[model samples]
Target chain A: MAKTKARVKVPKSIKKGEVFQVKTLISHKMETGQRKNKKTGKKISRMIINKLVCQYNGKEVFASDWHPAISANPYMAFYVKADASGSLDFTWTDDEGKSVKKSAKITVAG
Target chain B: MIHKTLETRQVGRRELMAMFGAGVVAAMGVGMTPRDAMADAKSVTDAMMKVVGDNKPATGKIKLDLPQIAENGNTVPIAVEVDSPMSDADHVKALHLWADKNPRPEVASFRFSPASGKAKVSTRVRLSKTQNIVAVAEMSDGKFYMAKSEIKVTIGGCGG
Candidate 1:
């Protein structure tokens, strides 16, 4: 309902060929659309963030498909290998095809 | 002869109890249905078939991390890891999660690539009640690994 926001955390420093961790969380209600309006007695249509894609240095690295079972304000963590000095982009899309994108920088030391 | 008769009667009674238990669960499922999302519910068998098809997942190489009992079912933490080298030729393709007793068996799916570098993921999920959380990992080599852990939900999350 409000403006959605996302946060990404990457290691401050990285070494070449080293595996690093990436953690992300987004603020969302994740309405399942299964609940009813107590006063109106009508069903609330499902609206949830359905997909997430993580790209490292412009290439797809990790992704996930979320169902209604995912908790509101989802948080996820995964690992990535440092290839070069670049940015990691994360795109979260909802059931309506509307999406939000966030990015973080990664510097791999030679 | 008297002891033998008692043993036979006990076995029959156990069978009857099992039949009644199954019937009760089926009735509960229907009673909770709201015509749409609830009715799309699935049993464990159908859920697995839809994902892995006819190939049964082998029970190893996968680890499921979850609390034995969740104080709050609204947000249950879950982590899954697979033991693999994570190479281009043999890495985990996707990891699937589902709960056995929820109104709907579908949970979430995680897709990975070689760049992922590790066969692990962590997230939070909502559990409708006490149930087994099943995780299945699909490898690039067409092999499937499976693991399951049960979580007792003290406060049932009925949003499902």
Candidate 2:
């Protein structure tokens, strides 16, 4: 397993009240616990990101509950309306209470 | 004389077909492999019913976009949007996605707030086979809207 990396993209030109897209990508094996280890003949336990949430400024804007059906190296895109200058926080958490957090800044002047 | 005897011992096509059919039927039977069990329409509806409950989602506000045919099932791109004003008074509460043919019915669910200016999202999902992808949108008022579309997968994502 390699080091987990989370990437986020925000449009360079975000104006006040304008609807913009926020893209996110993360690296994970997303093991579904269905396959058996070839040599050991033991079922590989499931390990996947269980949820992702986004917070704008101090408020929660978007969140996702992910199941194993989500493909490996998960990618998600969503829209956000920035009414004022604030920071965006993204967190991806797995079943065992482990989580990855990333943040971005946006300047929307009134 | 031995070659003639060997030909007579060879299995006939009719018998071979019967054996293949039985294998398929056995695979389709319940409890064969619960982790990779194929889902049917009734099972899909029942699972959706568990979420939407008595509201009975209507089919108008959701736009589920999926490819008519996916060459690769490992990473089929999908997008969904619901018709909503996204105002604090009336906004989309959540969006749920389901791949009916997968062993598990629930794919993912996204919660939205007014700050999410648009009730739109896009993501990638794994499809076990050719099946319907269902999307349901829940409005702030508790009304649910449903939309379903099918994707034909040439190769299933799940490999045994």
Fold similarity of candidate 2's chain A to the true chain A, as a TM-score: 0.93
Write candidate 1's Cα lDDT for A1-110 as tens digits: 24999999999889988888899999998887667788876668889998889999889999888888888999999899889999999999998899999999998888
Instruction: Report how far off residue A91 is in candidate 2 (Å).
Output: 0.4
Task: State TM-scores per candidate.
Answer: 0.83, 0.82
Docking class of 1: acceptable
**Tens digit per residue, CA lDDT, model 2, B1-160:** 6786577447444554554455446544533321122222234665555456567799899998889999888889999999999999999988888888896666888989999999999999989899999888878887889999999999888655
> Evaluated with DockQ, which candidate comes out highest?
2
Per-residue CA lDDT of model 2 for A77-100, tens digit only, reads 999997888789999998788999
lDDT (C-alpha, whole model) for all candidates: 0.80, 0.81
Task: Give the worst 10-residue stretch by lDDT in candidate 2 chain A.
Answer: A33-42
How far residue B7's Cα lies from its native spot in candidate 1, in Å, is 48
Model 1: pairs clashing at backbone N, Cα or C within 3 Å: A33-A46
Interface root mean square deviation per prediction: 4.8, 4.1
